[model samples]
Target chain A: MSEFQNPKARKRGLVIQEMPGEMLVYDTETNKAHCLNDSAAFVWASCDGVNTISDIVREFEANSKGTVTEDFVWLAIDQLSSKGLLEAKVEPKFKGKSRRDVLKTIGLVSVAALPIIASLAAPQSALAATSCNCSSNSDCALQAGMCTTQMCDNRGMTPSFTCVA
Target chain B: MTSLQYGQNFISFGVAIRFESTNARLLQKAVKTANKALIGNLKPTQKPPEHTFVFGRNKELGTFVEHNGSIVAENEIERGVFKYFDSYLRVRIGEYCPDRVFVHSGAVGINGKALLIPGNSFSGKSTLVLELVKLGAEYFSDEFAILDKHGRVHPYARPINMRTTDGKYRPYTVDVSDKADLKKRKPLPVGAVLFTSYKANAPFRPKRLSPAEGIMTIAPYTLPILVNPAYSIQVLHEVMNGALIVKSKRTHAPRFGEKLLQYLAKVM
Candidate 1:
């Protein structure tokens, strides 16, 4: 792990919307949207560039979030770092351990829900979701009037156009 | 090539556009088509157009439609020209509309609250919306759920396009305004957002989604998401704030619609 004990959340190039118990973070840089559950949101909010992992554990417990260990906090940091939500990437503390194994260890002791971040890549172009009645690449080229290479996706019950790089 | 002779400017949802044509007859047809596409949202505007569309016929390209001086669609048949223009105009307005967020959704008002089913074309949203309307729900739209800044849903009640089940998926339009009393439709507070698609023999078991998760689920169907991400996310956040979001797979629209209304009544 890096020597920097205080982890900061990345605020640049991100649009955040806080909900009842969850938070939606859109990374404009990567065009990815992440839904951070309550536990993860708490940990992310606590990462103010001054709180160490141990400090976050105490804060998480004091907030009536159930007793959590450093391992639990590390788990959230690992995910946040990997998703580019953290300002500085932190090396995985559980280096060689499988995620299932790590979660199993964390799940046994923690009473609160484990921190989870669900993510999805936003569409490259909004038109991809629109209906296009085309059966071939040439048809999409003519219909959409774009010069880029595109293919007709017929796997679904209906056909649509998907841009190909 | 025939020089464009007639042109008209229209403003809809805060976006201004101009349509021109070489033939006067075709220009009127284009105006009529644009009005239908926006469900009468277009209004005459003297302001300069932000985007200009030209429809004309020539020996080289035959019948063609051009947007911003680029040929978007060209065909030998004039009928294809209007069809292409209708689709193109809807997408362009949806992308650039400054005051509203257009989601590819089917919306219906039930008990004065709106239920939005967000999906793309051929996702069976139109079919489900038709079934709901038949069950006495007020129809809002089958193509778009126009959302205001406060996340209230306004009616975009165009004619529902139903796909024929003859394996060709040809669509036929159905106007439910007479039966649904769409003239009385008003903006409604969103009560629920259902994300589901038709699957063969699939049972309707719904999974509740968190607000953030709900935004992610509907992001792809949001028209201005790429054009204005901040505004789109803000509006979507308002939508998810007070609405129930669920995902499920269903077998048929009629049966599923009945069950869904019942389930919503008990839960919502």
Candidate 2:
């Protein structure tokens, strides 16, 4: 089980929440909601402290079977920026998750790990781990933003849960 | 440059109208009454007075004008409007500002959220709108509404501009009892362009329209449909971006206005 922690990357002006099948982005200026599809969702999910734009591109490229490119990632970022989504944060690259490291490691990762990471990066699963399920859903006897279903040992991962019924 | 003062508040404008001819003189009472509205409560923002001159202009404003062998009063029809230069519109509480700049026959001091209705005659444009006032909709303006460059349509709560049985609009005449500026014209961007069709018995029908089609439908509502293609495109682009355009119709005027109001309640 892997932990999905997004570093300070989303942007200053938006509120991003993970839903069941889609990721919802709320733009405060227009008071509107914009959603991301599977591909866009992949890029948005990879906007974590451990990933760079190159990492996002590589992951998306693998998902699309190498049909996308770096230029497409840049263009997508531009489109998101225009839609008031991805804002310029001026964040320096993390010591371990640098661009070159991403290019090299991403080149080595097995295509087998793509779907696994995608499932782990499930927008709803990420949200289930973060939000206060105990407060909103009375049945949620669990803490917020963590997999509410079951508790694990030192795995640091949320285990699958089942309903009482 | 005479300034209009309402009660104790004085709002000045760069453009001023002076009654110089018999037709204009006829509208003096209406202008003065309209000025009372300007002075009473409708506050438009005011700008510092500026001065400029147009090269070819004739006759002062608010008077009957003789053009091309036909007598058209400024109150009757908008003519030579191309001659205006450096005009500005402002809407604030007590400052003398233009209610709308793109207007042909405008009066300052009027106030309200301008509800624009632009459509060809017999489109039930005036009938449904007048009925709206009867059904508790505030009267913004009659025909034309004023729009800014950014396409913000001002809301001027003037009297309803309905064609009376005698064929004229109803102006607010309580305080002054003057001859009304019955047929003044302005090219207002429709706040809700109901591209309507009058029916004989069907219930009022209101539908949402794409912004593009609304613009195309609203252009003709502006006074003076000249031969200029650019004119249609210009007005069309602005109205499309700035306001909510819909397709509304009713069997009769009463149900039409009520349903139109009901639809606006959902959107606005």
Candidate 3:
């Protein structure tokens, strides 16, 4: 496993929304929404296949208007990887180092918090349930009105539902 | 082609629900109820509906809604009806709303600005909004705060859907005289976003949340934020800009409502 592979980061069908100092990414694949801090956003944006770990660090420092080590960039990468936001999974580089140790190594530069990505499971739209093709009940489990039984009607056309319990 | 006869009824926020039922009376009642909820004091929409929900009910299956043509809900009529309505509003409002963002929160206009209490269904949004309404704040909505593109809150005042003593989702019209009597108040800029939930014996403790925190906290309860994330994010950023976002936990709703007004007065 290329643990040190420069992360070829591309949001997995995610749409990024920028706030005053943070970013909210809607992961279309997982239906989860993630909040990226300024540093995390910078690191994520810089994680193009072309940029190496050092490039991320430099970008973070420049964008955050502060100093952070390779650990800061790694921390963001770790989070993005864990959230499945990255197109290809990259192993965490902090093999022997802990978060506290990395923080201490980087020292307390200037920032509200370390680059962090916080997320929550988002609620789906109501019509998301019957809006798909299904053959069994479990297919509608994640939908707003979960299906108890699924039936494929009209052969190739979109499956219509009788009811949901 | 099972001869499932159905008709469409337009609802609030430019959504339409199509119902299929053998019981003509039940279907008519449901459509009437939905229309009453939609056109409260406002003119009926002439625009065609954008989405259609096909629901059916019978003796053996009791009541059920079909998604695509498959059964999604069954056995409970009230549950099925409300589920259909909730799903339709949640989906279509966000889908067609190019101008507003929907928050699953209770909103009230206090001193010319909107005070929004954001939470999930069981998070005491309706109860808290009702309490605020009794305290002389004009009710915007108990279920949603439809925030326009300019960050102002509009009234989506469907009769405050509340759990009756018998544990049914009945319309609570304590503040509004009739279910169809909706107030056509001008949209107000959001003064504060209160992220609160009721707790037993927990004192009202409030902590200020940053705009990002506020958006993140309310994202789950917001419609279209997940489906149309890009537009949702843009709308939310505008909707939450310059608004005070406070996370509070309280046991007493009336006391919390009073304190909320006091807090808004100071902040706004």
Q: Please provide, for model 2 over B1-268, each residue's C-alpha lDDT reduced to its tens digit, 9 standing for 90 to 100.
A: 3332311222343333222222433234333433643433322334332321111224554323222223322321222121110011112111122332332222111122335655432244556556665676544444334555445454444444343333322212211112233224233344555556766887665676555344334433332222222333354455555556666556777766666666666765
Q: Kindly list the per-residue Cα lDDT of model 1 for residues B40-113, writing each as its tens digit.
A: 88999998889888878889977877888888766566665566567668877988999799999999999989
Candidate 3, residues A15-126, lDDT tens digits: the string is: 7777767888877777777888877777777777877888777776666548766766777888889898777877766767887887666556535358878888764443
List, in the given order, the native-contact fraction of each candidate.
0.41, 0.00, 0.38
Which is the better candidate, 2 or 3, if ranked by TM-score? Answer: 3
Top-down lDDT ranking: 1, 3, 2
lDDT of 3 by residue, B1-268 (tens): 4435645445455444355566676566556545554544222444554444455666777665554466544554455455445445354555555557877778998888888887755467788888888888888888778887777888877666554444433334454534343444789988889887777777766898777777777777777675567777777777677788888787877787788777778887
How many clashes would you count in candidate 3?
20
The per-model lDDT (C-alpha) reads 0.83, 0.39, 0.66
- Interface RMS deviation of candidate 3: 7.2
| lDDT-better candidate, 1 vs 3 | 1
DockQ of all candidates, in order?
0.30, 0.01, 0.27
* Candidate 1 lDDT, A7-121, residue by residue in tens: 9988998889988789999888887889999999999999989898999999999999999889999999999999999999999888899989999999999988999999988
